[model samples]
Target chain A: MDTFAKLQILSGAARYDVSCASSGSKREAPSCGTGNTSSSGICHSWADDGRCISLLKILLSNDCIYDCAYCVNRSTNPMERASFTAREVIEITLDFYRRNYIEGLFLSSAVMQSPDYTMESMVRVAEALRTEEQFGGYIHLKIIPGCSSELVRKAGLYADRISVNIELPSQASLQRLAPQKHKNAILEPMALIGREISTSLVERKVSRRAPQFAPAGQSTQMIIGASPENDFQILRLSQGLYKKMNLKRVYYSAYVPVTADNRLPVLASPPLLREHRLYQADWLLRFYGFSAEEILSEDAPHLDESFDPKTAWALRHPEFFPVEINRADFATLLRVPGIGVLSAKRIIAARRFSLITYEGMKKIGVVLKRAKYFITCSGRSFEKPDQPPALIRQQLLLSENREALVSAPSKQLVLPGFFA
Target chain B: MNQYLYDGTADGLLSAIAWILEEEPDPEKVMLRERMDTLFEEGFTIGTDATLAESLFFRLKQFAPDAAHTLYSFMLAEKEGMETSLLHYVSLAFKHGDQVKGYLTHPAVRDIVYIAKKAGRELHRMKGLLRFEKLRDGAYLAKMAPDYNIIHPLADYFSRRLRAQHWFIYDVKRRTAVRWNNGSLQFGTIEQFTTPAFSEDEKKVQALWQAFFKTIAIPERKNPRLQKSNMPMKYWKYLVEKQGE
Candidate 1:
C-alpha cells in the first residue's frame, strides 16, 4: 500500500473493466528497446466520459473474496482495499513511464486472496514488467478467471493484450448477475488465450520472441443494460464472439446502475443510447457487411432510436433499395445508408475515372441526403424512386426533421433529421 | 517563360512536382512561387534546378519505389488544381510502369488520401482529446495546432504518459515544442510563449472534468447532433476538459 494508495485502491477496483483498447498491437520499436507498439494502439487519452485515460488504468488489488453483485470491489462494497508490491507496480509504471505520465499498464484484479492468489499477483506484474523493468511499454493483462494454463501462458509472455471479462451476456445472465463468475470459469481462460494466440501464429515458435502472442488481440466486456439480455441476445453473443472466440473486441458496457440490487434494472442512466446503438450494430457487424440476422430480430430487440444502424437497416430492407451509384459492388456500395468505409472506398475509387453522377455522388462523398432515396444514377432519381415504403419512411422522417431544425440555431428541434 | 521558384518546402513541393514532370510546363506558364525571392519580371529563375530536382527525383525513384514517400507527401499537400493533378498523376506514372500501383486507387490519388486521412483523424483526436493542466511551477502544459503531421504521431502517445512529468507539447500550428523533462525529449521553436497560470488544483480538475462532461450527456442522448458528429466545433477551442456547462 502506497504508490498513491495503490493507485486509489487499484484504480477504484479497475473501473469495472471496460477494456479500454490500446488496440491490436504490432510491437516494433525495439531496434534497441526502450518501447513502442503503436500501429494504432497505445495513445488512448479520452476521459470526459468517453474514458480511455491513456493507460495507468490500474488494479492489482481490490481485496475481494467474491461477492460479485455487480462489483464495486464486491465483498459487500465498502470500498477502500489496496495492494501493489510487484515492486510497487514496477515503481508506479517506471514513475509513470518516466514522467510523461503513461502509455501503458491497464492491469486488473479482485479475486485477491485466491484464484491462484489472484493469478499469482497478476503474474508478478507481468514478470516484473518483463524481466525486471525492461518494460517495453503497452501491457493490458487481465486473464484471471480460473487462472492457470501456465498463468494464461505467463500472461502471453509479458502482455501486449489479453482480456477475459465475458461478464454478463448470458449463461442466464451469468447465473443471475455474476454469481461468483463461472461459465467454465469465464470460458476456459478464453479458450486458453485463444489457443495460445493461435499456436504462436501457426508454429513459427521462436522462443522469447513470444512477445507477439497477444499482439493486441482478445477483447471482451458485455454488461449492457445488465441481465435480461436482448439486442437480439446481445448480437447473438456477438455472433459467437466473432465466429468462435477469435475476438478482437466485444466491449458494450452501459449498465451503470451502480448498486441497489434486487436483481438489477431500476435504471436511470446507462442505456447510453443503448450503448450507442450497440456500437452502431458493432460497426455494421465489423465494417458494414452486416449480419447477426441482418442487424436484429426476435421481435426487433431494440435499436431504431430513429434511423442509424445503417439507417435502420436501410428502412427495413426496402428490397435493398435503389442501389445503383453507377453500378454498385463493394458489397453493394456498403449497403447504401450514408455509405462509409471511407465512403465505400470512395465509391470504388470514383467509379474508375468517372460516370458516377447524382452530381458524381455529391463529388464522391455520398450521403446525398441519405443516399438520395437509396440510389440510382444514369437512370436518375435523387428523390422519388417508387416512394411508399410508408411514404419513404415519412419522407425520410421529414428530412430528419428538416435537418434537426437546421442544426440547433438555439436548440429545441430535438433529433429531427435524425442524423440526416 | 519557364519561371520556377517552388521552396514552400516538402523539398520545395518535390521540386515543383519534379519540374512539371520533366519540363513540359505551359499549364499557362506554370507559376507556383512560395519564395526564393518570387522571380518573374520576364522570367528565367529556375534555381530549384538542383540538377533538375535530381532528375525528377531519379524518375520518381525509378517509377514508384513503393510510392516514393507517398508521392513525396502528396506533392507537399497539393491544392489549387495541383499542377493539373500532378500532371495527370505523372502522366499515369509514365504509362503504367509498375502498373503504377493501380494509380493508388485514383480519384486524383483518393482526393489526397481523403485530405490526409481527415487531417490524420483530427490529429489523432487532438492527441487523445488534449487536456493539460497543473501549472504553479509543476509545469505540465499543452497547446495544439493540429490540422496534421499530428506532431510526430502525437509524440508517441504523449511521451509514454508524460514520463515522470515536466511537460510542454505546444504545436500551435508548427511553432513547435515537444519538451518533456529529466527523462528527456527536446525539439524547439516555441519562441515567445505564455499561457501558464492555472493551479487551484488545476481549476478543480477543470471543474471536475466539466462535471464529468455534464454528467455523461444523455439528455435522452441529447445529440448536439451526435455530439457534433463525434466532437467537432473545430475541437471546441483546445477542449480544456470540454469547457462544458
Candidate 2:
C-alpha cells in the first residue's frame, strides 16, 4: 500500500490511545536538523473532538498477534491492516516536520511477530532520525510489554518520552480480557525506565554534557469503565504509580466499546462524564495538594458529577471555610473553591501591598461565584454569616444550573488559561 | 490642552514617553497618540530622534528588563488607544521600580499586561499554525495575516528551528514577507509577487494531512464548541487542513 493509504489506517487505529501531550523535554535543534522541541508543546490544531494534535500520533502497523477486547485493532477484529517500513516512517516524519505539520512523531506498533522485534523496528526509526538525520524533535515511543531491557534502554536514548500502557487497571481484568499480557510485563519496563531517568538526572547534574535518557520522562494510560474498578481503586492505583513509578502523566481513556465481548459490560456510550470527573480528581491529586484518599474514599467510590472535585471537597469540609483572603497563606488560599494554582499565587503576591477585598479578589483571577461561600474579605464574609453547609450546597447547585444556562447560549468551552 | 503625536513605533513611543517624563504632562491636559490629523487647537508632532530613544531604552532596561520587554511586546499589538495605556504602564514602572512586576492589581499595569499576553499568545500559536509548502523554486513558502507585527519576533525562532532550510513567511495582510536563506533573514515587501504553484509532492502531502485530520476526530466525542474555542474560526482560512473543507 502507498504511504498515504497506510497513514489513514494506522492513524485511525492509533486514535484509541489519547495521550496527546508533546511538552515535557526541551530538545534544541542540532545544526543539521530541521525541527526543535519547545518548552511548552504547541497545539497546532484541535480536532473536532477537541483533542490537541500536538504530535503526529500514529502507529507503525495495525496487525497484531494479541487480542485485547477493548482495543479496536485487536487481531480478531476484521479490518484493513498495514505497516510502514522504517525508512518510510523516517521520511514521512521529516517531511511533516519541515512543513510544521507536527511537533514530532509518536510511533507505536502492535505485537508483530514478537515484542522484541516490534520494538526493534520502532527503535530503528528513532535511531535513524536521531543518529543519521540528526533530528532533535520530540519523539514519543510506546514500549511493547515484555520487551528486553536492552531494547528499552536504546529506545530511551533516542526518544524524548516513552510510555508503557497499563491497559487494564487490575490483573483480573487483564486476565479476563487480554490473557497474553500481564501486570509484571508492563511494570518491569516502567520500573527500569524510572531508574534510568533518575540516574541520568544525577549524571547530568554532575557533568553538564552527560547524555540525556528520556528527558521528558515516562507516562502511562489506563482504560476507564472497561473493568469493575471504581474511582477509589483507580485513584489509589494512579497515586501509587505517581509516587512509586514517578510517571509524568496517567491518561484515562474512557472505554469506547468496539467489539462484542461477553466479558465487557454493555454500554450505550463512552463514560465521558466519569472520565472528566476522574481528570478533575487527578488534577487535585497532582496540583491541589489533595491525597487520593481525600478525593475519594471506599464509601464514596464515585466523584460528584454535579460539581468539580475541588468544590465537592470544599462542601464536605465546612471547617475549612471562610479563609481570610488577606491573611490566609498560600496553601490555605489554594483550598478555596475556584482558586487555582495560578490565582492562588497571584493573591499571595498582590496581598503583600494591600489587603485583598472581595472585589479585589475578583480582579486577581478568583472565580467569585464559587469562592464567595468559602472566603472572607478583610474579616467580612462575602456570603451570609453562619450559613449551613447543606444550604450552601443547595444554593451552589442552583447557581450551577443557572450558570450553565447562561453559558449554554454562548456554548463557550473555556480554553485553558494562557498564564502558564 | 497639548497633544503630542509621534510615529507609531516602539522607539518613537519610547521617545514620547521620555519627553513626558521630563515634562510631567497631566493626563487631562496632555494627549499622546500615533501620527494622525488632530482637530485640537494646539498639537506638537515629535520627530524620531535616535539618540534620545536609545538613551531612554537603555534607561528603562536598566530599571527593569522584564518591564521593557513587556512594553515591547505590547507595542507589537495592532490595537487603538494603546498609546495612553503604554504611557500609564511605563510611568508606573518608573515610579515603582521592580515592584511593578507583581502589581497586577494596578489597572494600568493590568491593561498593558493583558495586551502583551494577547500578542504573546498569537506568536506562540503561529509557531504551530504556520504551514509551509514546497514551491517549484525549491523554496518553502508560508502565508499568514496575524493581528500583530510578529514576523520579526518569530524570525529568531524559525532561524533556530529550521536553520538549514530556505523558507519565507509572507504576511498577506501587511503586504510584506520575511525570507530566511543561508542562516540569514531579510524583511522586505513583495509588491508584485503572486502565490507560487505548490509542487505535486507538496500537494499530495497536504492532502494526506487533511485526510488524517478528518479521520482522527472521534465521532462519539465531537465537541465543535471546544474545538472552535481553542482554534478560532478566524485562523481557519490559512490552515491547510481546514481549507476547502
Candidate 3:
C-alpha cells in the first residue's frame, strides 16, 4: 500500500495506544550519526482531548490474529488492514524527521502472522532506521507479547524506549476481555526487558561501549473502566509495576466502548475527566511524595470529581491543616490545598531572605481563597481553622459561583474587578 | 534641557530614561530626539551612555531576575505604552526595593504581564505543535516568527533531537534563520527567502501525515473551535504538517 493508505489504517489502529510520549530518552547525535535525540521534553502536538502526539505514532499493521473485543482493529472488526514494508516505514519516518513534522517514530504492530512475526517486523523497522538511514531520532517500539527475549533485547538496542501494553489490570479481566492473550505472555517480556535494562546500565557503568537498552525505560498502558477493576486495584498494579519492574509510567486509558457487546459498558464516550483525574493522582504519587495506598482506599475507589487529587487529599487530611507557611518544609508546603509546585518553590526561595507574611503569601502566588483555611503565615490566619469544613466548602463554592456569574458575560461585565 | 538620542532600542531608550532621572531635568522641557536636527535651540544633545545603559540592565536583572525576560519580550513586541509602563515600574522598583511583585498586581504592570504571559503561552504551545516539512535538498524546513524570542529557546531542543537531519527554523517576523546541518547550528538572516520544493518521497510522506492528521480526528469529538484555540489559524501557513493545497 502507498504511505497515505498505510498511515490511515496504522494510525487508526495505533490511536488506542495512549503511550505517545517521547520523553525520558536523552540520546544526543553521535559524532558520525545523522540525527540527535533531545533531553528536554519533546515537542508535542495535542489532539482535541489534550493528549500529546509528538512522534510519528503508527502501527506496522492492523491485521491482528487475536480478537480483543474492546479494540477497533480486532480480528473480528471489518476494518481495512495494511502493513508497511520496513523500507517504506523507514523512508516515511526519515522524511517526516527531515521536514520537522515529528521528533521521532512510535512504531507498533498487531499480531499479523504470529507474535514473533509481528515483533520481527517492528524490530526491522527500528533496525533499518538506526543502521541504514542512520536515524538518531527517538524510536519507541512496542514489544509484542510472547516475542522471544533475544528479539526484545534487539528492539531495546535500536529503539530509545519500548513498552508492552498490560491491556487489562487484572488476570481475570484479561481472561474475560482478551481470551487469546495471557497475563504471563505480557508480564514475562516486561520482566525480561526490565532485567535487560538494569544489566545494560550496570555494564555501561563498568565498560564504555555497552549498548544502550531502552534508556527512556519502559511504560505500559491499562484500559480503565473496562472490567470490574477498581482504582485501588489499578493503583496496586501501578505501584507493583513501579516497585518490581521499575516501569517509567503506567498510563491509564479510559475505556471508550467501540463494540456493542453486552460485556462492555455502553458508554457513548470515554470517561475523559476520570482519566484526567487518574493522571493528576498519578502525578501526586510520582512527584508530590504521595503513596498509591494513601491516594485511594477500598471504600474510596474513585477520585473526587470536583476537586483535584491534591486538594481532595488535603480536605480529607484536615488534621494536617493550617501548616505554618514560615516553617513548613517543601513537601509539607506542597501538600497544602491550593499551593502548586511553582508557589512551593517560590515560598522556599523567598523565605530564606525574609519571614513570609500573609501579604507575602499573596505575592508568592498562593491561591489564598482556597489556602486561607489551610495555612498560617507568620501566625496570622485570614480565616480561622475552627470553621466547619462544610462552611468552608460552602464559602469556597459561593466564591466560585460569584466568579462564574461575573465571568459568564465577560464583555458585558466591563468592570476590571469582575475578572479579579 | 537635555534631549538625547535614545537609539530606539531597549537599552538605548532605558539609558535615556536613566539620564533624565540622573540629570534632574524638567519633565515638561525634556523631549526625546532620534536625530541632531530634531533638537531645538534650548535643547542640549546628550548621547546615550553605553555604561549607564549596561548599569541599568544589570540593576533591572538583580531586581527582577524573571521579569527581565518578560521585559525584553514585551519590548521586542513593540507594544504601545510600554516605555511609560516600564518607566513607572522601574521608578516604583527604586522606592520598593525588589518588592516588584506587588507592582505586578497593579493595572499597568498587570497589562504588560498579561500580554507577556499570553505571548509566552502561545510560543510554548507552538513549540510542540510547530510542524516542519522536508524540502528537495534534504533540509528539514519549518518557518515561525513567534512574538517572543522563542526561536533560540526552541532551537536547543530541536537541534539536539534532530541532530542527524539538516534542518532550518526560519523566523518570518525577524527574517532570520536558525539552521543546523551536520550537528552544528548557526543563526543567519533569510530575507525574502522563497519556499523550497520537497522531494517526491518527502511529498508522499507529507501527504501521509496530512491523511493521518485528518483520520485521527474522532468525528464525534471533532471540535474545530478547540483545535483553533490550541493551534491558532495565524500559525497554519508555516506548519507544514497542517493540511494545505
Candidate 4:
C-alpha cells in the first residue's frame, strides 16, 4: 500500500487513544537542529470532535498479534491493516513539523512480531530523528508491553514524554478481554521508567551535561466504561499512579464500542459525561488540595452528573461555605466553586491594594453565579447566610438546568478530551 | 481638556505616559492617541523623542521590573480607547508606586491586565497556527494578519526555534516582515512583495499534510463551532489544509 493508505489505516486505528498533550518539557534547538519543544505545548489545530490536535498521532502499524477486545484492531477483527517503514514515518513527521502542522510526533504500534521487536522499530525511528536528522521537536513514544529494559531506556533518551497504557482498570477485566496480557508485564516497565527518570534527575544535578530522560515525565491512560470499575475505584487508582509511578498525567479514555463483544456492556453512547466528571475529580486531585477520599468517598461512589465535582464537594461540606473573600487565604478561596486557580490568585493579589467587593469580584473574573453561595465579599453574602444546604442545592440545580438549556439546545455538550 | 499623541510605538507611548504623569495633567480630561490625524486631528501630536522614551523605559524597569512585558503587550492591543485606558493605568501606577500590580480588582489595572492576557493568548496560539512554505530558493516564508500587532512577538518566538534556517514571517495587514537570515533577525517593511512560487518538494509535502488533515476529522462528532473557535476561520486562508477553496 501507498504512504497515504498506510496513514489512513494507522491513524484511524490510533484515534481511539486520546491523550494529546505535547507540553511540560523545554528542549531548545541543538547547534544544527531544525526544531525545539516549547515550555508550554501548542495546539496546531482542533479536530471536528473539538479535541486539540497537538501532535501527528499515528500508529506505526495496526496489525496486532494479540487481540484486546476493546480495541478496534483486535487480531480477530476484520479490518485493513498496514505499517509504515521507519523512514516513511520520519519523512511525514519532518514535513509536517517544517510546515508547523504539529507540535511533534506521537508514535505507537501493535504487538508486531513481538513486544520487543515492535518497541525496537519505534525506538529506531525516534533515534534516527534525534541523532541523524537532529530533530529536537517533542516526541511521545508509547512503550509496548514486555519490551526489553534497554529498548525502554533508549526511548526515554529521545522522547520528550513516554506512556504505557494500563488499558483496563483492573486485572480481572484484563484477563477476560486480553488473556495474553499480564499486569506484571505492564507494571514492570512502568517501574523501570520511573526509576530511570529519578536516576537521571539525580545524575543531572551532579553533572549538568548528563542527558535528560523523558523530561516531560511519563503518563498512562485507562479505558473507562469498558470494565465494571466505579469512579471511586478509578480515582483511587489514579491517586496511586500519581504517588507511586511519579506520573505527570493519567488520561481517562471513554470506551467507544467498535466491535460486538460479550464481555463489554452495550451502551447507546460513550460515557462522556461520566468521563468528564472523572476528569473534574482528577483535576481536583492534581491542582486543588483535594484527595480522592475528599472528592469521592465510599458512600458516594459516583460523581453527580448535574453538578461539577467541586460544587458537589462544596454542597456536601457546608461548614466550609461563606469563606470571606477579603480575609480568606488562597487555599480556602480555591475551594469555592467559581473561584479557579487564576481568580483565586487574583483575589489574593487585589486584596493588598483594596478590599474586594461583589462588583470587584466579578471584575476579577469570578463566577458569582456558582460562587455567591460559597463566598462572601466584604462580609456580604449573595444568598442568605443561614441558607440550608438542601435548599441551596435545589436552587443551584434549577439554575444549572436553565443554563444547560441555554448552552446546549438539545443535549449535553461533549468536550473533546478529559483532564484538559 | 488636554490631549497627548505620540508616534505609534512602545517607546513613544511610554514616553508620552511619563510626560503626562510627570506634568500631573487632569486625568479626567487628558487623552492619549497614536499619531493618527484621522482619529484625532485637534490633539497635540508629540514627535518621537528618543531621550524621553529611553528614560521612561528605564524608569519602568527600575520601578516594576516584572510588569514591563505586561505594559508592552497591553500597548500592542489594537482595541479602541485602549490608549486612554492605559494612560489612566500608568498614571495610577505612578501615584501608587510599584504596588500597582496588586490592584487587579481596580478598573484601570484590570483593563490593562485583560488586554495583556488577550494579546499573550493570541501570541501563544499563533506559535502553532502560523504555517511556513519553502520557496524556490529554499527560504521559508509565512504570512499572518493577526488582530494585534503581534509580528514582533512571533519574530522573537521563531528566532529561537528556527535559528539555523532562513525564514521570514510577514504581517500582511501591517505590511511588515520579521526576517531571520541564518541566525540574525531583522524587522522591516516591504511594499508590494509578491508571493514566491512553491518548490516541487514543498508542493508534494503540502499535499500530504492536507490529506492527513482531511482524514483526521472524526465524522461521529463534527463540531464546526468548536473548531472555528479554536482555529479561527480568519487564519484559514493561509493554511495548506484550507487552501484551494
Q: What is the C-alpha lDDT of each candidate?
A: 0.65, 0.85, 0.73, 0.84
The clash numbers for all candidates, in the given order, read: 21, 0, 8, 0
How does each model score on TM-score?
A: 0.36, 0.95, 0.81, 0.94
Considering only chain B, what TM-score does candidate 2 achieve? Answer: 0.88
Stretches off by above 4 angstroms in model 4 are A409-420, B1-10, B21-47, B78-80, B91-99
Write the residue-wise lDDT of candidate 3 on B112-207 in tens digits: 666667776766666666667667786777777676667766787676656666788888888988888866789888768998887666656667
Ranking by lDDT: 2, 4, 3, 1
What's the distance in Å from true for residue A294, model 1? 12
Structural similarity of chain A in candidate 2, as TM-score: 0.96
Q: DockQ order of candidates, best first?
A: 2, 4, 3, 1
Query: Least accurate stretch of 10 residues (summed lDDT) in model 4 chain B?
Result: B214-223
Docking class of 1: incorrect
Q: What DockQ class does candidate 2 belong to? A: medium
Which one wins on lDDT? 2
Output the worst ten-in-a-row residue range by lDDT, candidate 2 chain A.
A411-420
> lDDT (0-100) at residue A284 of candidate 3?
77
Q: What is the C-alpha lDDT profile of model 1 across A324-389, one tens digit per residue?
A: 877778888888887777777766665665577666666555667777788888788878677856
Residues A107-184 of candidate 3 have per-residue lDDT tens digits of 988898899988988898898888777778888999999988889999999998899999999999899889999999
| Segments in model 2 whose C-alpha atoms lie over 4 Å from true places | A406-420, B1-7, B22-31, B35-39, B42-47, B97-99
Q: Rank by TM-score, descending?
A: 2, 4, 3, 1
Complex DockQ, candidate 1: 0.03
